[model samples]
Target: MLNYKTLLFSLGIAVALFSCKNQETEKKTETKRPNIVFMMSDDHAYQAISAYNDKLINTPNIDRLAQEGALFNNASVTNSICAPSRAVILTGKHSHLNGKIDNLSKFDTTNVTFPQILQDAGYQTAMFGKLHFGNNPKGFDEFKILPGQGSYYNPRFITKDGDTVIDGYVTDIITDLTIHWLEKERDKEKPFLLMYLHKAPHRAWLPAERHYKEFTKKEFPLPETLFDDYTRIHPEDLEASSPDAASKKYNLDQPKSRKSTAAKTAEMNILTHMVLTNDNKLKDSTVKKLGIKERYLGDPTNRMSKEQKAAWDKVYDPINKEFEEKYPEMDDKDLMKWKYQRYMQDYLGTIASVDENVGRVLDYLDDNNLSENTIVVYTSDQGFYLGEHGWFDKRFMYEESFRTPLLIKWPNRIEAGITKEEMVQNLDFAQTFLDAAGVNAPDEMQGESLLPLLKGEKDAWDRDAVYYHYYEYPAEHAVKRHYGIATKEYKIMHFYYDVDEWELYDRKNDPQELHNVFYDPDYAEVREMMIKKLEETRKKYKDSEELDKQFIKVYNDK
Candidate 1:
């Protein structure tokens, strides 16, 4: 009986010790900070993303995030430009507050970014690929960034040691560098924040040889508003103002809308600006023979080596030869059709490389057993115009340029296949990240934490509107300075500086934004309410007319 009791006591002690060990493991798991993989591509249109719309191209890898995670339908940027958009994401503040309102302006180094905060909280931060503006980004223990609009092939990266050129396609090189850092340099004991940025599908789109061959042959459907002249003023459109008075004052025979002025003044028309030699890769001799003036003389061949040039010529020469034979006999409309095809081919080809690289990174996480404890985010700097309004660039408050694609996946934390309709901006990224890591966001950061929405707490999210402002006017593309408020139901904009115009649109009624109803008597109450809302939003964000004028003066001095 004594021997049996001793045996029982030994077993009980063993059970207690095992239970204590299990509890300690659970505590460690609970305390571990999730790793972050924030991926951003330059000028990647939401429409181009297959998850949002499969009409343009099929991006299986990027779409995988949306399938398994949360896809934000109303994700947008505070400013629809490159540097400013990135600044907003980093500082969790607007362009004005960050002091990077335009690409020309220098980034205010004093502002504390999310990475800096994360680094302070014992996180290992590393950034690779296109930082776009800054040579040395803050808070990152290691970074390899493109100087400025780095080349698509054999690009130079600015590292902590010094500048070095990597020999390969940029998209592939960036992915390789990121993976190398993860597999070799990463500390297994610490959580990490990794930023992977891409410069693909930006202006002067250059793709890898494999993608160039395939996408060039695949023709894409044109956007519905490809030929939009921006001049049509329907009878109902005129009813907003006194029709008789408007007709007499503005000449009804050729009615012009506000879009007409905005569109015509802007230089983004692809047909005129997208040169065949510079953009479409037609031979200079062929272009000369066709009596076409090439838009710019920036030939990618100048940067290519003998072998790289040979490879490029092997693919583009045949396509250019076919164009030379056909374009001579084609009319303006037919030429527009051809140019649109070429544009889609080169642009989408680069995106193909990006999609493939994204898959590689995701697979790295899955193979290494990091998916469950890592948060992967895929987004673009800003949305781009892909043949919409006959345009090809971004920098407007229009839907095509404003609404960026945002997808996030945090296994076991965020439910799969969730589609969020609430408006979220790049501005929310910093706070959202800090909240997820259990770190305190700086009080000066203007954006709200997106934790509630990311965790599928719809009732906890309460943003009714978003504010936007663009300051780079009298510059490239000539997009006028504008500020606006966008809600689920309406959008009100004031185009100031060179042009003083106020436009409002009922987002539900005019989904395409084909009409401006600011003066419509039928929408008088809505207009008043929206105006009040805009004022309140501006006040809340701390933007004012005085700042607008100050920025304009700063711009003028330049």
Candidate 2:
């Protein structure tokens, strides 16, 4: 009905309107997202980090994370094991819900993850280092992960297309690969989510050549319970004249006693932190000689090149010679002490490299002008026992292993130099990442978004406590199945596998968790209250004896 001139004019107005709408949508998308770098280390203990406790060792690089932003004073893991912790972080769900309660359980990648949410929301995602999940990772634009436990020296990494062995330390190599992706492969147009993981400071601690000799001579002060004789040593045995030399030699008593059947079964101790050929940097011949007495444990020299072995020999041969001369004559208690020192040295040495590499990543973000908009986080899978209770591994509900170091820096949104004492779990990680990208987390996700807490909304929300469950029973370390709830004031736990026992600790009076007052008459009222809370928490998480019974067959197979 209209003339040709009128029709052309109408078409022109419609084109202009559509362009403006599209531009606004693009701007909105850009404004909502922030780049994220999640830097995690395997088995790095909170006590070992200088930021949490400065008495043990210096960690200037990790301390920078705490200094620059918020440090979580009460960060914890639901499950203290490796792969289970990672699974909880990814899915924002508990172990039972996520179906990865223990290392033996597979991480079902089909479940929705925060990375998938971000990826769908137009964020470019990259993961480097130990993904730990056996299968190839999903929801990432690109990934290069270590195979199995991955090696310490010249580790092999599995990439999208294929696998290649990179010649360098694992921590250093991970950082190198991360920077490479940031510099070359990343899409400049999209915001990124990069998960940088480290394999050092895990089991069979192995340090790189640079840090091999570090902390070798320094004898770290032992934990008060490093020689916890379990009160088996009577007062008479403590006498100087006693024939029980081990009991008399190190006369010490735990402040308050809270013995459990599980504690009696614990097998992971500093003495159990055995040195190996590659772990101790010993020559194959030296390890064999130590094995003659059937005292030395673990496998032979790890896979390494001739040049690599020679370099290791240069550093450790002298130490091995000294140890070989002294160890046989030493008493059992003294031998345990010596082994503890060796374990700590190598463990701390590996951490030194991790810290140095952390500095590299921090530098990268700062140098590239990414610091302003990017969120930087440093944490570990869970806490490890640094000779606490004479132990070296994690998986205890004890504070030494329950608490982990968490430092997060978001320059634009979060103020620097803040510490939050609220109890936050790794389960909250997925929701937080989703919140950062302005993406809504699914209702199925169990963890509440930690964004409010991290943003200094101290009173914005209230979660009175956190729940924990561990189920790798009849497995390694002989740690029984346990579940508990930790409020700010108290922690109540029940170890139900192989034995039934309850342990309750008053956090204020005994922060070290040295004693359990589960049966004390003074705590009768509190016990009732905590038990009710524990029941509620269990119900909230959908974890109970019935659930375990349903899944018991799975773990039983092994």
Candidate 3:
């Protein structure tokens, strides 16, 4: 009995409402695809983490991630160097496959990275902070990265559009970029992949002013192997020497009255600071005061030998006058202490700034609702030796240099207060991230998915062993090129460069790895069994076929 016009109008309204409802449904479905955020810290260690029971440092925000989700106690890197580890994390492939075996090596970015896969799947991807792989980030939609080891204070970042040299602490700058990307430019219809990387507690332990005195009062406990003589296990010829010996011996502990004292201090400080800040430039006054008598500055033709006198003249002429003016009464010891304290302050100050920025990033994530959907992972390039093993730099296969701290959190998916003891590697992180996003990982990746382990499904997976290789030898740390296989119970290593040797440690009996048992009569059978397993692993992981032939060479050389 309704009129035709009225009936047509009612039908039109119903169609409009139905269309709107369908659009809303589609929007909800899009948002339901989980967003992913992966974060990392350079050279952060498990021993430094308060959550892992070492109470000397306060990393409350990093600890919060573990509290909210899961902490993997045994996460390790495949190649324990900065570039190689990062490459593995990006490509989910071993160093051999990634073409990044050392810090100086370049990465081949043509291969499928998890970010690229996510982007292909309609996710918007972005990376901010340190990306030191020395290749253009191919998969990310947007990226702002530090040029090499970015400064702890006022770092310089390079972007696809242009390079940006920002005037804030590095951590804060990275976080700011991340939040800005999230709030402004990101597509609301698509899920996001935000990578927030940090340069914290890396070499030179440069903390900010706030964290300067944070751990100053508490004496850091010396490592168990602090005084270990290399002659006992590793022969003197094979043992890697500390990089900071020049600093520690001449600048750190030596009396500074010697004419070359200031010069040595300045040199060490410059090298140390350079690692933290790429923009580090020595002041004229600092140079003069340090008595650095070298000035090959303008003469390209002047060689180090030919310019020695000229260099000495240029370096010391002003310094000598300054020295006479500044310290009429200062003795050798006084000058030494002054130089040592200055170096320590600058280095530790940088570390404080990094920690403060960490707090800032944590605060930002919390402020945004995106934190619930995000997974924050904090780790380092590799572990650093802070006077451990009498060393300062990394690259050795030792525990202090090899074991990095790994903290992860995903609010909705991961279970809180769970600690996984499975042996995990940095190489596995890429696959894990891809798995979390339900993306297909490429076949070239050597890592296995850790999703089940992260989710508290302990019985769902079984991985018994982890492998390690360090190829950059006779360079910075003088660490011999070595490869090793470690399990939950034992570890077997072979050093093939410089001096060929094999080392074995039964972790159940000697957890500290103080004694090498490759030559032990008690472990002969164990050694035989491990050798077979190691070969099998090498083949399975597609490691160099040369490893098998080199084992005998290692034994014969030793």
Candidate 4:
């Protein structure tokens, strides 16, 4: 019964309300999807970062992420090796499922990555720095990666345009490219996922010329297990001369009468096989006086420009001169100690440049008011040894190399100054990204989302265990193939490429993992429990001896 004028007035009111509500919803949806910047360094150990352990070096800039947001106390990777770890993070599955079991195996581009999912969800995706995979990655819209093990000075980057040698330190160059992409190349309207990887603190650790003298005066404390004799172990019996020998039949759980081959490997010992001038980043003439033959001491700084080499000489010449004067009269023990010191100085020095560039990224985010809606994650491909167990490389399930550093900052969602103690692995990162963007993770993904843990809701997360597998054997460093399950209190593994051996550790009693307590009578109940758990974990991840054979076959064929 109302008139036309009143009816038109009421309809206009409803239409205006509807339009305003729609605008508000659109604005919310726009702000909800956070920009993810995952920053990673190669072989960066949790022990070196001040956020976890500050004995070796102080990493203030990297610590900012943990302080301003949340630090993951138990973050780890499915595989301990490099390329396989990277592949696991990209796909939310184990290496067995992803087909990237080791560095030798090419990453199957057919596998689904988190960036690919983000791209489908309307994100502007790009990767800068070392992807370290061949056949050119497919997910990122733009990629400029280091060709193989990139140089520290005048590093060459492989891009769609071809390989371009950029004249600068690799860390600084990578950061410059990242900033350029953010300011000039990236689309601001859409959310972005940027993978900024670094080759710093990797093999043949090289620092910038500026930081050569940074850690020269600081004498780092050696690891408690630095002189570990490998006497206390549970090694499998050697192959017998006769095929019918009873001892040849192995017992995987043999606890006593064990021996380890870690100290004998010539790949990464600071005292033995580490090239003098190359690994230590010293002058050639100075190293020559130490009686190290020129053939043994390779050149790591051959790629440095004239200016770069001059700056390097400015710092190293005096140090090397001092070393040559003192090393001649020293005995084997003193010489070994000197080598350890040199290795620590150069290794920690290279990390300083990484810390400096991280500060640059943090400052850029703060200055541009981009920190609030963006999630910043800092981690490494895998942890490396800082002379632990008389070794200096990864590819073992030991605690030093098993646990990587993981720090995340998301201002809008994750509360500041939070520490998540729940066990989480790199594989969980993919599902977490998908959940953040409101996209559904595929069923094939094997990891659970860490969204709740990141939000400081630890009670909501029930995962208390993680599985680790390292398959690179008869390769670099010569670590035997092993897989294990590590919970908060226990760790048990099988080193089973040729010989079968089971090792267990009570993390509470021996945090350093110095003793293999697989046969200790006190830990009998614990070992039985952990063995069952390991079996469950292997079955859950669909990792069996049969699948191991397939992975090994593919790796060998490659």
Candidate 5:
């Protein structure tokens, strides 16, 4: 009915409208991929999180994540060492497979990391904070990480472009870098993956001045098993009986002198910095009197002349006075206990800064309308023993050191406050990230995707047990080399350092793993069944061959 010119005009308008509509739809589809922010705190434990019903202290930021998403109740690590555990998380492989079994070992960055995969898949990936694997972080489009275990106060960062030392608290610097990247460098057209790792609450616990007085007025309640004597509970053959056990041991009431020979030696090394001019050489008397022992105390090399010894005596005089004042009546054990308390105060206080920074990240997401599209995850490198089993550091197969807190939040998906009791490990993090990005996990990865569990598809998932191995032996923390398998119902740990010791725990009856039933006459069948299961797990995970080789290599090398 319309004229030819009118008909042609109508068709042109319809085509223009369709084209605009298609462009809008394409933009919406492109933005549908979720942005992921993964955060990790150094040495954070499961029992320290308030969301996990920890009544001791508050972790509001960590609690918020749990409240808004799923909190995994039984998340653990394949290895309890810092570098090794981090390597496992990045590669989704066990320490043996990754060849990063200890802190001193280097990480192979050529391997595929989830961030690398995401980068390849057209996502902007940035890592800000501690990437302590001692290797260059590959695959990240932008990276500003601390060179090893960074300082708590005014830490240094190794940037992707250059080595620039930023002045501020470690947490503040990390957060600033993250916010800056988000505002300036991140691509708005595609999703972004940001790894925000913190160097808080590590050894020599140093807290910011603001939080220094946080726990000064209150005394943390000593753990119930503070006095647990490993008489019958732990086997003599266990790796916990290693010679280096003395280093990891802690007491509850003793204060140690902060100025020991080691401290003085460190001070003397820095004293050279105070030398006014190049012409001023270190005085021989000053050097000799500093109690700088070259070797054993009574060795001929350590012997000093009267004047030299006198100077040494003067330098050590303050140390002796401080030591005597700190522990006038207490023995070494009691003195250690006092030091532990002070250490705990500083350690827990450091966590306050971490909690505060976590709040900042959450607030940023909410303020920018990114909360709905962001998947937030909070966890730690590994767990630490806060006076548990009379220990202070990690690397043990014990429950306190093995389990880590894992919390996740995604506003568009996942229910709030729901806790999944399924056994999960750090190795699963890579696959979980890959799954979130709709990317297929690599075949070499040992972890299973947790997407189903997060999506409330528990019935459709098939996972029951998780494998663990700690291979760093004759190393730091003195925790014996061990391997084990943990299921929902039971746990079996085998210590191979000494007389082959086996620890079996019935989780349903002994959730705390207080009792070792490997020697119980009634559980003989159960022990055999668990051992068989352990063997089967080793074989299934392709760890048996490596374990055998490691056992032979350790003895042969020794």
Candidate 6:
């Protein structure tokens, strides 16, 4: 029998042991959730980033994410259009399911987004820069979005308070707002989802004052397929009928045999349709002498202030004069070279600003001690054509336009300098973010979480192929509607609506995608296998002829 003192002492010791054990258990279970900083640029190409290919441009800041974390070699999008691609990212579903099939279609508000789920799970959410569609973005605690294809100079931002036009380069302004939110507005206690998007490198590529001077002086190497003739279009077909005649033949109920008009129908050839004054920044008088008319839109410089206009003239005036002097001697080939150079100068210049601003955000994270617990992701809305296939826009299932750049860094979690070849899409971003935070993704979400792949768990991922669709046709650029499945070795696309064509590519043999091997007898076995895969993928995704007809009806009505 113990005395009173001994019994009390024993009781106290037991209580202390129990309390310590409980605390240890709590500590083990309560893992700190990671903050996500998602940075996306508009129309940024993988080829432009030096991490993927150093031949095109040197993007040291963007490459920093790739060096410090994992670079996805096979990251792509479901759809290649801007607004539709964005909708897919937000909803984690394909365009057909999300009801944002094309840029003209309104976004379905009833659908749940990952940001909404994150916000519900006690994560602080914010979005800055172009949403590209809706003004009032759901699930964000704070947002300042660009009003539908915002300008490069003196861009107007729509905010919760009201619309405010900030007077600076749009790229710098967007970065400034993002950093400001990080430093001032972000809640310290909770995890955050920050979307810092850029409007630069979109349409009418306008660079900041600092970049245009040097970029204009430097000439970039032309793409090998810059002067690509439409080899898919036959000689007789070229003289058969125009796009207008083909549109009339396309029946609403039952489509006609449009054949393989995919290559020739589009008006995206950089030499002809890319207007001199709208895209290339030629002086109005110089364009008049060259027999060029402003076809795309009015001069992009018309929105500039006096000082901005003066600075633009200071750089472009000399280039215009040189072009005018060379116009007499310039042939079609010479003109193509000149136009390609001009396009690259302005396009790449915008990217330089994006790279600089990305460095700013990365440094802020490092300086603030947020690097260890934060997940930083970098990507684009979708890949752009940097003169690949003799085109300047994205509306195709081709490799250059289909593939987007994806880099993710999470200190002490993801191993540095890793490259993943698994086929991941923007569709996976939602579930990945939710999974990283220990939140359950909604059942309606269709994307697989990339958390395992990000953490270097290669065997945990088993996806061998990805799906792609493009649905903006008889519209700008005139890219025919198509959807396909892409494995590492092969790709098959079916162009429909105005044309019914099944095109296949042997990716391993022809990396440039210069040849279509659909009708080749040698590839019959491969074609049969790919066709079965395509049908299975389409069915797995719940896309059917009914959905196709429904979307076509909506488009025709519009």
Best by lDDT: 1
Give one clash count per candidate, in the order shown.
0, 0, 21, 1, 11, 0
TM-score of each model, in listed order: 0.95, 0.88, 0.74, 0.90, 0.79, 0.91
Clash pairs, model 2 backbone: none
Residue 54 lDDT, candidate 1, scale 0-100: 90
CA lDDT of each candidate? 0.88, 0.81, 0.64, 0.82, 0.72, 0.87
Error of 4 at 215 (Å): 2.4
Cα shift from native, residue 22, model 6 (Å):
14
Tens digits of per-residue lDDT for model 2, 1-558? 999999999999998999999999878856857899999999999988998888778999999988889899889999999999999999999999989988877788778888888899999999999978764787899988998778887888898789988887788889998999999999988999999999978877877777776567668888888877543212321233222222233231321333456776777865554444534545557757766333444543366678877876777778889878986787878867877877888899889999998998899889998888898899999999888778878898878788998999988578888988888999988988898888999998999887887787758659889999888888878888899999889998887857666678899898867667655556656767888888899999888888988677777875
Across 37-124, the per-residue lDDT of candidate 5 in tens digits comes to 9999899877777887565678898899988999988899988978888889999988878878778766776678888888999889
Per-residue lDDT, model 5, residue 199, is 87
Badly placed stretches (over 4 Å) of model 6 are 1-30, 232-260, 294-296
Tens-digit per-residue lDDT, 1-558, candidate 4: 989999999999999999999999989956678899999999998988999988888899999998998898888888988789989999999998998988887788889888888998999988888877873777788989998777888989988888899998999999999999989998989889999999988878878777876777668887777766665454332222122212233334343355554423436666766667777766776766566674444678889889888887777778788877887788876876777888888888889999999999889889988898899999999888888877787877778888889999988688888888788899898998899888999999999888887776747788767999888877877787888999988888787766567777878788888777666655666767887788888998888989878767766776
The residue pairs that clash in candidate 4, if any, are 235-258
Error of 6 at 207 (Å): 0.4
What ranges in model 4 sit over 4 Å off? 1-31, 233-258, 261-267, 283-290, 293-297, 554-558
* Higher-TM-score candidate of 3 and 5: 5
lDDT of 6 by residue, 449-472 (tens): 988877767488888889988888
In model 2, state the lDDT of residue 452.
85
| Residue 333 local lDDT, model 3 | 43
- Which residue runs does candidate 5 get wrong by more than 4 Å? 1-31, 233-326, 331-336, 551-558
Of the candidates numbered 3 and 4, which has the greater TM-score value? 4
